[model samples]
Target: MFSFSDQNGFCGRRCVWVNGPVIVGAGPSGLAVSACLKEQGIPFVVIERSDCIASLWQKRTYDRLKLHLPKKFCQLPKLEFPEEYPEYPSKKQFIAYLENYAQKFDIKPQFNECVQSAKYDDACHLWRVITVSTNGSTQSETEYICQMLVVASGENAEGVVPEIDGLKDFTGEVIHAKDYKSGEKYAGKKVLVVGCGNSGMELSLDLSNHNAKPSMVVRSSVHVLPREIMGKSTFDLATMLMKWLPLWLVDNILLILTWFILGDTQKYGIKRPSLGPLTLKNHHGKTPVLDIGTLERIRSGDIDVVGGIKRFNHTSVELVNGETLDIDSVVLATGYSSNVPYWLQETEFFAKNGFPKTPFPNGWKGKCGLYASGFTRRGLAGASADAIKISQDIAKVWKKELNHKKQKVPSHRRCISTF
Candidate 1:
């Protein structure tokens, strides 16, 4: 039990007994935390905003999308993907795996319940969570109190739409990458894909396969590398290279190596921009189309690479070089922004980009128990790192609470006494 005193008197103090912790978001990070907590026999409730687990994977990913990392490295801890699955699981297979994981652990999250806000109550030393759920005709808001809060909401919650001038006025359909699932919807349409990221590249390929006649809008030069370099996974190769060299040196070396392996993309109207991997700052490192059968399609004049969209009208899109393209729809794969709205307004503990500040010392010491995971840039291995760190911290806090409870026993009541 914990109590916080008010200025009125001892009678004004509010006491809250520890029940269990609350985990917000049911993504990979949240599921990992829930598994760890369940293993420890710690009571917890996981809240998800969607109707199903791994909804983002099912809803937001485009067709032909595959895991950037190998299957061996991308799976949750203690759960191995079956050998029947491919080297890189597809969106549908990944979602099925998550379903199996949840079912195996008996982790049934309360879905369709979205968290609106959470605030710490000093008087009770607990976090009060407010959630909204739709109930047929009317909506209802429910509240829950917990001793701690774990925010596992991923960084890509809010889709980013590039602020293009006069975009709204264009009559053609405009869609973000989140709304794009398959190229089937774009059959026989003239599609202009904006951005040169993985989503843009893969979506263009899928569209071309569906006879959509898609054109890619390249803003700047992009570095294209094969998904596997020298018969190994790209991630594995990058890890090995980075281990022995500085980041800059490693990036330069990889760039040179890729250029030698894959001829200059300039012949296809694509230029090599970065020397290394595509990063937040350097968005130019394009993954090699992985020879996933897309190369032959490109060589057949199915996919056309064009300059960036300088401006657009109802029926025509003008390129940066004054070239014009008449398209039926625009698919913007501009990426996502890191925004956690619920707690950002009330807490000063967050990054400039709105992610929660990590390595919370006081919260750890006092057992206040607020922590963030999966916001760091460890690529596909980020979720794993977050799980390890969060589990260690939770264990420390749980031990401290148990010790405090044991200390409350009277000396005479001890079963075994030490003289």
Candidate 2:
């Protein structure tokens, strides 16, 4: 069912025709969908901009990074983590699991193919995906034509680097959290860590552990919850409670427990948001920080917590509170956003921010056989659910159409690639 594209002429442009779908990512979301479609006896070709699978995990993540949530909730569909893996698998462990998943499912993505544009042809009734790839000094382009197109590039495809006043003037090491690997290089130096999300918190902790002084910026209010409650995971507890109790009640209970365990985080320059953690996340997509030893480090005076930045000097940072501190490096953990809007031509299904106009549980499907897999802010569990739904829905339609087409079903789909 999978073969090289026909050598026929299309003005010398390479083209690939897919009978099933062209999945536009090789990350967990796309992998999950591909695995499910394979189970349904569907054919698909994954296209990844990066060469390796899960490039974020393999290349961008820090050395000490581990899953913020437990492994059970993070696993993809049709496969479970190995029993030997810890509750929170490290970055390497997670990457290993993804590799094994890809191997098991036989999901071979066309790596290094970055989609330039994807648009639907109204008259032809097919999705056209134009991709550009570079190999050494040589570059190539490919166009894929398919009935169904699965947009699985995900939310964190690109990093967000904010415009900071005097950032260009600062004469010190500046890096985004994506390129940061370890604090080994910053040992015995003062480092300014921007953003207070999970990455910022964990990165600051790692800096302190490596003997580097880290001052994290907490500009706005954030909900910092204990990673565990007594012996149970806070995430697990909340999920369990939400099944039977209301979300508000569950939020309140978790907050109370967090206060009891972590004490008044506000006293340490950290402010909790007005809305409850779950409510804020649901409404505004602001995820509460799950404290993983960062609070303890802060309390112990190991990791300093600072306020917003007014500007940066040659060797000092001016804070909104009129305070200033000298630092040797800066790590902007400003987070990431989706690149869907940049390449996706349609506007109705996806908003200007690149997320679906419809939210999770309903955002997976769209008109003209278009689908999205990981726009869900709910993480792996939500994505896994979407993957199953997308596969099943596509299967139903594909089967019906095939039955109607009868003997006209083509055995080979075209693909365009030239060495």
RMSD of each: 5.4, 4.5
Query: In lDDT terms, how accurate is model 2?
Result: 0.92
Report, for every candidate in turn, its global Cα lDDT versus the true structure.
0.71, 0.92
lDDT tens readout by residue for model 1, 270-346 = 77653555342233213433435444456678988888777888888888889988889999988776556644334
lDDT of 1 at 284: 25
- The residue-by-residue lDDT of candidate 2 on 238-354, one tens digit each, is 989999999899989999999899999999999999899999998888899998899999999999999999999999999999999999999999999999999999999999999
Most lDDT-accurate candidate? 2
Write down the worst ten-residue block by lDDT for model 1: 358-367
> Where does model 2 exceed 4 Å of error?
1-12, 407-419
Q: Cα deviation of 410 in candidate 2 (Å)?
A: 16
TM-score of each: 0.85, 0.95
